[model samples]
Target: MNLKSSVGLLFFLFTALAKAQTDTTRIKSYADQVMVRMNLDTNIDQFIFTEGPEDKQLETILMTNNKTRLSFSVDYRIISATLSITPRFLPGNNDNELKGTSSYTDFRFRFFPKKFIQTVYYKNIQGFYLENMKDLFPDWKEGKDPYFQFPNLRVQSYGGSTAYVMKKDFSLKSIYTQGEWQKESRGSWVPIMDYDLSIFRNLIDGQKSKETQYSFGGSMGYFYNWVLGSKKRVNIAPNISLGAGGMFSSSWDILDDGSKANRENTEYFIFKFSAGLHIGYNTDRFLFGGKFNVNANVYNETENQSVQNNNIFGLLYIGYRFPPPKVVERNYDKVQKKIPIL
Candidate 1:
């Protein structure tokens, strides 16, 4: 080849390389938006220039990190199974604090001809929401606020759900769950009724209370996936979900006489919503990516009393894909000889 022809080829190669780099940067930018919103600790550069094989059909997606672990595999892209675990963390100056943890297991066994998918899931979560009470009394003097020490609060919840996915992007889910909590408050808190009774009344100061809630709810969401790069190896998906439910709750306070007092049992309502973004680089060998989710929940007992919870979190993970198993053939005559007559 002539010298001018060789120079032309080199320029073409350089241009293609520059375009590939730019696409990688764009995917990283989208990942950054989700991470920053949830305050997750991640390095974008570590993920941008990753090395992997060319894109192919992925039968499974597995990912894990300090806060979340997810593993899901499928058969013929129709029948699927998944396992996920999520842990809660509260940011602190020196080290992050563990707020809670939960486990989720599900199986998607039913598939309609071309339009629908269904999943049955079971979940159990145990944690506490400590931020609200802390914000309520930021500076409590030890002597003056003797009854106002930080609450030893704990919440336990378990539930199951059935989800239907339609057209591969939209989903409608219904869930039934039960939860129990031990809660307490002091320093003269207002009650949630027509009367002016407070939690920290003269009759019931520094008392611990027990509450239980049963709820049924449904959620609707959509997910969109974008593939970038000439080889279609990089993928990103952003999803949004909204849900509402009614809950039956019952709570009673402990009186100074070591007996239950002010027994109140009533039904309440709750609403929740969340938005998440996920990014990954998938190849024949392995997959790597991170997901960030921000969510909020509101609980209302009466028209005048309500509690709100807002939380943000995310996870980073790397996973490997296993090869499909080989099919085995059996001889009918040999099997019949080994069988005993009934």
Candidate 2:
């Protein structure tokens, strides 16, 4: 389906399931508590382009130099938000001399209503260098020779996902946002819909080009949260999903005379796979966890050319929960009186 239609369908499904009955016997809610989290992660933003047939295929990998990110987040009631940045002080984040300078920024927000989860995010990434220089050049030396770089290539994406849990007793929140805890082990089937708009800009030899892509997809995932320990404070969760989608892309170039060239449009079928494992220790007031997640998308650009976008990340986080102050609670109550959704 198209992006608009996919979004409309997600809205309809969300409203239909908004009031779906829920059982909280196996879960514990922390709606009255404010959660603050600090996270350190190694998140790679990269893409691989392959051309020609399998035996004679040529591969070009583009990757950002900033490989680590630190983020801070706060969650209260039904709302959560996070801001992330890559700092040069980090060990692996400051190799600008070898990989060229790069920058990355991300902002995300999430809302929870009953069994439905809604998320929205924005990401900005620029500057990439060829990661496999040795394969391309037989005499290339890693420290002595500089790799090919795209100094003016930038990608920005706006995206979000909507999901609903089919099981009433399972706590998806426990595995994701940590807003709630599950007292018993359980599993659930979750159906999710995701949509995104991406803009790519590049400048080469004073010529500018821009491309825009729109994509949407639906997927079904199974999540199992295995609770352990006598105190029920330790858990391991693993989830996987497979999906298919479509992408519409359009591109145009700026001519030397300052005129625009004819826009080119292309459509492609996309295949997606995502899996993750989360292990955490949670208590009423303190929590710490680690997570590993990977997502891959493959699409053919032509009969002999294809592109793959691979995202892999590992995260470690520690958080604290406490009762919200009266002023904070009162303000939220006031906002909720008008919006009602919170």
Candidate 3:
């Protein structure tokens, strides 16, 4: 071939090689992501990455630092079947309220706290709203004006709320703000008439006084109690606690997003994990309890990468009771038999 044709052929070959290299690079990157997703950990160095007949890379669609849509349950059958208890703590830092150790041991009965078999879709701002269905306002009466259509906005959030309960069974409650609580309510920040319940408490072992016990509960929560060792009067058994739930949006966002970008529908997930101390005191009518809760949680918002965490305090509260578990008492002297004729 002539020099011109040879040069042209070489150029074509080089271009093909470059394109193939680029494709290979992209594939590797994608594979690395996949592996991370499968492992559910950002630290991918734990796995060996290579290319072979039996090896291929992956793309990670989900990353889990704290919340990555995972659930864990413990069935420590032998000592206890199921129990629900929570912790109470108070944050000393001026800027935060729940900033230290927290715990919620038992709250598996309320909300029909069954086996936690339901998958509740909750978050702040948009707790539970219809999405797949068409939005339609109620029809007007004869002389009434035509009602407008429902707004197309979604504001799903998940954050713990503090409230004051005066009556039992949440007959009346006042909801507090979420993060970095403000001391003053501003008077206009009318608190909600009621809240589901508060799971944090302070175990006041001082004077005989009623240490305000907030009903320890989680919207999407459950409990599985298990006793792993021999039961004793001063029994100290290790345990685990997990609670997860989401919050709802308000009507304000509904109106705003209704007439705007219509891109405001998203959900947030909050999960709490507590592992610390569990002390149960047996009584006939009630059970005195104590828990020094240390908890860590992850807050996740849809379509966002900046997932946050908080070390919630005031999550450990005492004074929870249950049916008096039967205790067997034995005397060692009655069974001691030794030969005296030595």
Better of 1 and 2 by lDDT: 2
Q: What lDDT does model 1 reach?
A: 0.37
Across 277-300, the per-residue lDDT of candidate 2 in tens digits comes to: 788999999999998777778999
lDDT of 1 by residue, 1-342 (tens): 432353344344334433332211111111001010121232110001112233531121111112333434332222334444332432221112222222223232332223233334443322222222233466744333322212244334444444444432211110000000001100111111010111211222476776666666666754444455766566554555667776676677876687887777786566766555556665544556676555555675344445544444456655443433332113323443585220
Clashes of each: 0, 0, 33
User: Over the stretch 274-338, how does candidate 3's per-residue lDDT look in tens digits?
Assistant: 43333343322222333332344445333333333332222222222232223311121222224
Worst 10 residues of 2 by lDDT: 13-22
Strongest candidate by TM-score:
2
User: What C-alpha lDDT values do all the predictions have?
Assistant: 0.37, 0.87, 0.23
User: Best lDDT goes to which candidate?
Assistant: 2
Whichever of 1 and 3 has more TM-score, that candidate is 1
Model 3 alpha-carbon miss at residue 300, Å: 6.3
- TM-score computed on alpha carbons, candidate 3: 0.25
RMSD of 3: 27.7
TM-score of each: 0.48, 0.91, 0.25
